[model samples]
Target: MRNIKMTIEYDGSRYLGWQKLGDSDKTIQGKIENILSEMTKTTSDIIGSGRTDAGTHARGQIANFKTTSNMELIAMRDHLNTYLPRDIVVKKLEEVPERFHARYNATGKQYSYYVWNTPVPSAFERTYSYHHPEQLDVTKMNEACKILTGTHDFIGFSSLKKTKKSTVRTIKEITIHKEGDLLHFTFIGDGFLYKMIRIIMGTLLEIGIGKMSPEHIDTLFESGIRSDAGMTVPAQGLFLDEVFY
Candidate 1:
């Protein structure tokens, strides 16, 4: 058997996230597995690096699966692309060591949230970016970002109410950049909980709009209270930038 690693990109506007659910649902993993099973004539499971929520896009998502077929890498890539949907594409495929597990071996992940901070509605970017009519103070947002750097208990940013374990995670970097009317918030982290990035973005946005003080950001780390965090931004604005091993 050989393990194949695939780098995938998808526009999540039409699908129900990355994982496969029931037969009634259409998912990114389900689509890939359907095509692979047909090509190999066997049961195949495609494991993803991480699960993106519905309507969340991916630019460099990674996945791996074991196969017994003796097909060449080029042929397998062509075969899968012929069967996969247009919204989802496999950018590259390669054989990897059997010991490499996509999810468990992932060292870190990078995500970006985009916002069109303007009054004009963008016809092309509406689906991919969030539109904010109010002007945001980018400087204040950057100041609040400092509070998010380093390791901290992030229970305040997570939405999982029933989670009993600690939400401690390390954020390696948080960058806020603006060019023209577009604003991008990039986060690099060892791991993240449900809706953590969106919540962090929301909190920073509040600071940008002068609704929340930058000094208040430290309360999230000290208290670990969900109420101390900001609202959860829409998932449509978030993108899984890449997964690194």
Candidate 2:
């Protein structure tokens, strides 16, 4: 068997999420697996770097699977693209060593959140960005971003009720930039817990609106309580930008 690695990009608006669900077949993973299974004439199980929430898009999601097919990597990629939905595309494909894994071998990841901060609705970008009509204090938001960086216990930001695995993760950096009526946020980290990015963005939005103080982030970190943080923002604005191995 050969271990095949592929980088993928998808518009997640119509799908349930990246993971295959028992209740629904409208999933990113399920679609790709179905095509792959049909091509290889075998049950193809794929391993993704991680799952993105519903309506959360991806620019460079990574996955790998073991296959016994003799098909070349480029041919397999082209064949899969022909059969898969137009919103989903395989960006790159290659063979790797037998031990390489998509999830277990990942070292870091980066995600970006897009926000449309204007009163007049954007006709074209509405579906891709979170629309916030209120004026946001960008300086305050940047302060909150700085406070959220570095290693810390992010249990307060995560939606998981409980987990045996460690909630502490190292955030390499957080950046906020603005262009026109749009605000963008980028987060680089070793890993993130469930809903952590969305929750953090919500907290930053509240801080931007003066509803929460920047120091509130400090309190949340110290308390480690989920309710102490801001609301979990909608998934549409979040994107899995890149996964590093």
Query: How do the residues 129-241 of candidate 2 rate in per-residue lDDT, one tens digit apiece?
Result: 89999999999998888889999999999988778889999999999889788898999999999999999999999999999999899999999999888889889889999
**For every model shown, what is its TM-score relative to the native structure?**
0.97, 0.97
TM-score of 2: 0.97
Candidate 1 has a TM-score of 0.97
Clashes of each: 0, 0
Candidate 1: Cα lDDT at 150: 88
RMSD of each: 1.1, 1.0
What is candidate 1's lDDT per residue for 1-245, written digit by digit as tens? 89999999999998889999877357999999988989988999988998998899999999999999999999999888888988899999999999888999999999999998999978888988888889999888888888788898888888878576878899999998887788988999999998899999889888989999888778777877878888888888899999999
Task: Please list all clashing residue pairs in model 2, or write none if there are none.
Answer: none
